[model samples]
Target: MKPELENIPLVKNEEKKRFEIELNSHFAFIDYKETSQQISLIHTEAEPELAGTGAAAAVVEKSLIYIEESGKKLLPFCPYVFAYIKKNPEWKRIVDQRFEGYDKL
Candidate 1:
């Protein structure tokens, strides 16, 4: 059976500026940069072993949850994150209003 996304422990490796989760021996992560009022989600990645296993989505979800709880605006710079937010419109609330593509999402 596939692992549960909710059961995965998301770690904010602030030193690395990434939120990470272990998948087997590898990690799925979202690269981000934070400012006083906004966080730019720069990229998302999952190892080959973790691909197609929802790892990327899991990381994105957890990262978005964290951003929402922190009350910071989000600039979803990565295409995957952008598509994910487009699919889940409710997440748009956390998007930075100044983002060039905010209205497009």
Candidate 2:
């Protein structure tokens, strides 16, 4: 993570069912759906300008931390989230083993 993005604030907009962060005048977010016991991360997006800015990684990290702190299982449906976890394996601890492709992680 870039030092500038290390502490980016995360906002959970329940109405939109997404977690967001503002970065360098644009927004990066992860779309999610929640059940009683888990959150399914469905997609991740960032403004084109955010490319190479580390914004995507920052928001993903923040959202993962939030899920851990909330004590809920994670269903990382988004390919981006899965790829991110592959790089940072510690996040597998919070993932719901029943996730359709858990073995791939």
Candidate 3:
């Protein structure tokens, strides 16, 4: 199912080589490799109250925009991200080249 994305704040600290956001004070970020132009979704979690609020999708969407702008691909290691890709076929283009594993899910 597509998530109910809202009020998401995407932030990046390039100096730290990471991009992140706050969901009820808890943070999430995507682990990436600049040279290979690949991003691995490292982790994501929200306060119990924020669960199912689409905070994960919002963070992923923002990161995808960054990938598109940087001419890179995404490695959705996190299961939530993998599921998001399945729901949003339009975002297939930015999917990582090695995403063969997702076809089974």
Candidate 4:
């Protein structure tokens, strides 16, 4: 099930080697730079009200799209990102390293 991008708002900005996104004003993202040809995911949190509603997943998807479009590799460090990639095969090509023992991507 693909989450709607419009419903899941994303803002991408950079801080040094990190690219970040804020989701629903509840979550913050940090994308690492210069790491094994990968984008390291960091910081993902949903507001209490948005939890269990797939808001985090939506953010991950949006972030993934941004990374893919930018032609960078992904190294999912955040637990949410790790899990999302595991369940979604279409995103596999972008992943360079997997977390939580999931290394296939």
Candidate 5:
């Protein structure tokens, strides 16, 4: 069964450069690097048991929302994140043009 995204609390762990969400007794997270101009999402993973439950997507979505609110362009370097944005083109608005190639990945 899919988890309720609204119930997951996404946390931005700046010191670790990742956004995390606790789920099903495990943690899902998206690693990123931020600069004044952009925030690059580099990796994303969910605990093995959380697979297929939308935990990864929940964290990624929340991270994107945070990046949007912060007004920084997004650089989706992680394959998963790139694929996510490609499917959710509305997020293209916040993506950095330099990494637009991610759409093709």
Candidate 6:
């Protein structure tokens, strides 16, 4: 059986500027940089063991939720995050307006 999303604990490591979740013994993380009004998602990675486990999406979802709750705009420079937002347009409301029409890129 697959693990429930709630079972995974996503943590924001402010000192590392990343959101992290543990899978097995490895860590999956989404790297980001924050300013007063915006947060730029720069990268995302998960251990090979976590592939196909939905761990990446879980972390991204949790991170985006946090950003929304914090009232910060998101700049998804990371391809994975960009793609995720594209697929989940409801989350686009929190995206930086400067990135409007980014799909054309």
TM-score of each: 0.94, 0.95, 0.69, 0.67, 0.89, 0.88
Which candidate tops TM-score? 2
| Candidate 5 worst ten-residue window by lDDT | 1-10
Q: In model 6, which runs have C-alpha deviations exceeding 4 angstroms? A: 1-3, 100-105
lDDT by residue for model 2 (1-105), tens: 689987778999999999999986799999999988998999999999998998999999999999999999999999999999999999999999988888999
> Would you list the C-alpha lDDT of every candidate in the order shown?
0.92, 0.93, 0.67, 0.65, 0.86, 0.86
RMSD of each: 1.9, 0.9, 3.4, 3.8, 2.1, 2.4
By TM-score rank, best first, the candidates go 2, 1, 5, 6, 3, 4
Candidate 1 structure lDDT: 0.92
Tell me the tens digit of each residue's lDDT in model 5 across 17-69: 88999977899999998899899999999999987788888888899998999
Alpha-carbon deviation at 19 in model 6, angstroms: 0.5
- Per lDDT, the best of the predicted structures is 2
Q: Which stretches in model 3 have alpha-carbon errors above 4 Å?
A: 1-8, 14-18, 23-28, 31-34
What is candidate 4's lDDT per residue for 10-32, written digit by digit as tens?
66665444443445456544455
Clashing pairs in 3: none
Clashes of 1: 0
Residue 41 lDDT in candidate 2: 94
Off by over 4 Å in 4: 1-8, 15-37, 97-105
On the 0 to 100 scale, the lDDT of residue 61 in model 5 is: 89
